[model samples]
Target chain A: EAGVTQSPRYAVLQEGQAVSFWCDPISGHDTLYWYQQPRDQGPQLLVYFRDEAVIDNSQLPSDRFSAVRPKGTNSTLKIQSAKQGDTATYLCASSFLGTKDTQYFGPGTRLLVL
Target chain B: QQQVRQSPQSLTVWEGETAILNCSYENSAFDYFPWYQQFPGEGPALLISILSVSDKKEDGRFTIFFNKREKKLSLHIADSQPGDSATYFCAAMTNSAGNKLTFGIGTRVLVRP
Candidate 1:
């Protein structure tokens, strides 16, 4: 089976610019998650969804970040007016169930905000 | 606060030697632990996992030794090979807490032939 897939494998933007990362989860998975991984660090959860409903998004920067899974099969994470601090790899993962199940991750979209 | 912590941010060992990565968690409720391995420029992949009820779990050359009372665990890679080099992250999660994982900074392992 195909693993989680993400678009724009790499993105470079100037400070204050906007970018959106897209994800297509596993075909039969019900849980999807977005994580940010800075250099030399572990992946940090930003938001997650079960089907088309968001389960947790406390880590997301409310003012500049937003995510949606309107159709329950795909997801989009958008960062508006990005800053240099937002430079990191954005990973998309999917699980058969929720976080209790094994999570398979996509290669990730590497973002560099200058 | 950091819920999970790992030791030896980086390590190197001969191909035939064994490499041990240590991790500890602060949340007593964390009942599931999983180790993920990531190569440069790639996403992490699940290496192995264990539940709280068990103190040990082994898969091929990888073994997890857990200590519930100590809230710690160690991942042991035996007969290491050069291709085994990667960053290993230790993560903990509790069924009660939405099963969201809390991960350690990660340990970078380099197996030299």
Candidate 2:
């Protein structure tokens, strides 16, 4: 089976500009997650969905960042206004269930904000 | 404060040697510990994991030794290869509260011939 898929493998934008990342999780996986990984840092959870409902988004910057999984399949994470610190690899992942020991990740979208 | 911490921001080892990576967490509530591996231009993949109830778990050349009381855990890579060189991450999860996985700053491993 194909693993999770993401779009725009790399993106470079000026500060204050906007960018949106798209993710398609593995087939039949009920959970989807979004994470941001700065260079040399671990991936941090941004938001996630259990089916089409948001489960947790506390770590997400509510002011400028937003994510949604409306169809219980595809998801989109958007940064309304980018900043230099926003530069990171945006990752998408999925799992079969909440208690699953493993999560499959996408190739990730590398964002370089200047 | 960072919830999870990992040591040796980067590591280098000879091929066929065992590489040990360390991780510790402050929150006692974290019961699930996992390690992730990522290569350049690729997403992180689940490498191995151990639960609070177990002291160790092994798969192939990888093994995870966990200590609940010390709030520490480690990953051991046996018979390492150049292909094993990648960024490794340690994470903890308690989904009921946040469905989030707190992660340590990754450790980049470089295996030499």
Candidate 3:
């Protein structure tokens, strides 16, 4: 079976620029999540959605970060006015509904803000 | 304050030895615990997980030991090999809180030949 997929394996941008990451979850999966992992640190939840509706995003920096899952299958995470601190690997994962079972992950998008 | 804490920022083990990674969480509401393994430049992959009802879960060379009262857990890798060298993260979640995983800082392990 195909696992989750992500686009733009890497992106480098200058401070104050904008960058976006795209994620396509596994087939039939209803839940998608976005996580940010800094060097040598664990991944932190940026946002998550269930069937096109945001389940939680309290951890996301609303002023700079925005995520959307329009049709409940694919998701996009955008960072505006990126700062050096925003440099990290953006990971996408998905799991089936009702069953918070194991999440299938994709090859994350590595971002570097100069 | 960080909700999840992982011990031993890094560790090194000889090949065929055992590697232990520890983790603890402050959120009592967390009912699901899982361990994730990540290789260089790759996303975290599900390693193994245990629900609140069970105390131990074993999958091949990996095992999870959980203590509900202590809100602590550990991952034990037996016969550690060079391929097992990576960063491991302990995470927790709850049905009521959604699927957002609260992860530990991560433990980097290196297995030598």
Candidate 4:
């Protein structure tokens, strides 16, 4: 089976610009997650969705970050008015439901904000 | 606060030798632990995992030794190969958090041939 896939392997933008990252989870996976991975740090959860419903987004910067999975298969994470701190790799992962489910990750979109 | 922590940000070992990576977590509710491996330009791939109920889990040359009381775990790669060089991340998840993972900074391993 195909693993999760992400678009725009890299992005460079200036401050206050907007950019959107897309993700296509593996087929049949029900849970999709968006994570921000800063340099030299582990991935941090930004938001997640089960099917088309969001499970949690408490960590997402609401003022600038937004994500949606309309069809429950593909997801898009967008950043508005990006800042220097937003310069990090945006990773997308998917998994099934259950306590023992293992997540598979995508290649990730590396963003560099000036 | 960082819930998961890993030691020895970087390590170097000779090929055919055993490389051990250590990790610890502060949360008691985390029952699932997984180790992920990533190359320089690739996303992380699950290497091995163990549930809190088990003290040890083995898969080929990789083994995970878990200590529930101390909330610590170690990943041992036996007969290490040069291709095994990569960044290894230790992660923890709890059922209450919708199985969201909290990961460590990661340990970079270099297996010299």
Candidate 4 pairs with clashing backbones: none
The CAPRI quality class of candidate 4 comes to high
Scored by Cα lDDT, where does model 2 land? 0.91
Candidate 1 structure quality by residue, lDDT tens digits, B1-113: 98999999999999999999999999999999999999988889999999999999999999999999999999999999999999999999998878598889999999999
**Per-residue C-alpha lDDT of model 4 across residues B7-81, encoded as one tens digit per residue:** 889999999999999999999999999999999878899999999999999999999999999999999999999
Error of 1 at B91 (Å): 0.3
Clashing residue pairs for model 2: none
Candidate closest to the true structure, highest DockQ: 4
Question: Per-residue lDDT of A1-114 in model 3, one digit per residue for the tens?
Answer: 898999999999999999989999999998899999888898988888989999889989999999999999899999988999999999999999765678888999999999
TM-score of chain A of 1: 0.97
lDDT of each: 0.94, 0.91, 0.92, 0.95
State every prediction's TM-score relative to the real structure: 0.98, 0.96, 0.96, 0.99
lDDT of 2 by residue, B1-113 (tens): 99999987999999999999999999888988889998998998888888899999999999999988899999999999999999999999874655578889988999999
TM value for model 2: 0.96
Better of 3 and 4 by lDDT: 4
Off by over 4 Å in 2: none
Q: Where does model 1 exceed 4 Å of error?
A: none
In model 3, what lDDT does residue B63 have?
96
Q: Per-prediction DockQ, in order?
A: 0.79, 0.73, 0.77, 0.83
Q: Which stretches of candidate 3 lie over 4 Å from their true place?
A: none
> What tens digits encode model 1's per-residue C-alpha lDDT throughout A18-96?
9999999999999999999998899999999999999999999989999999999999999989999999999999998
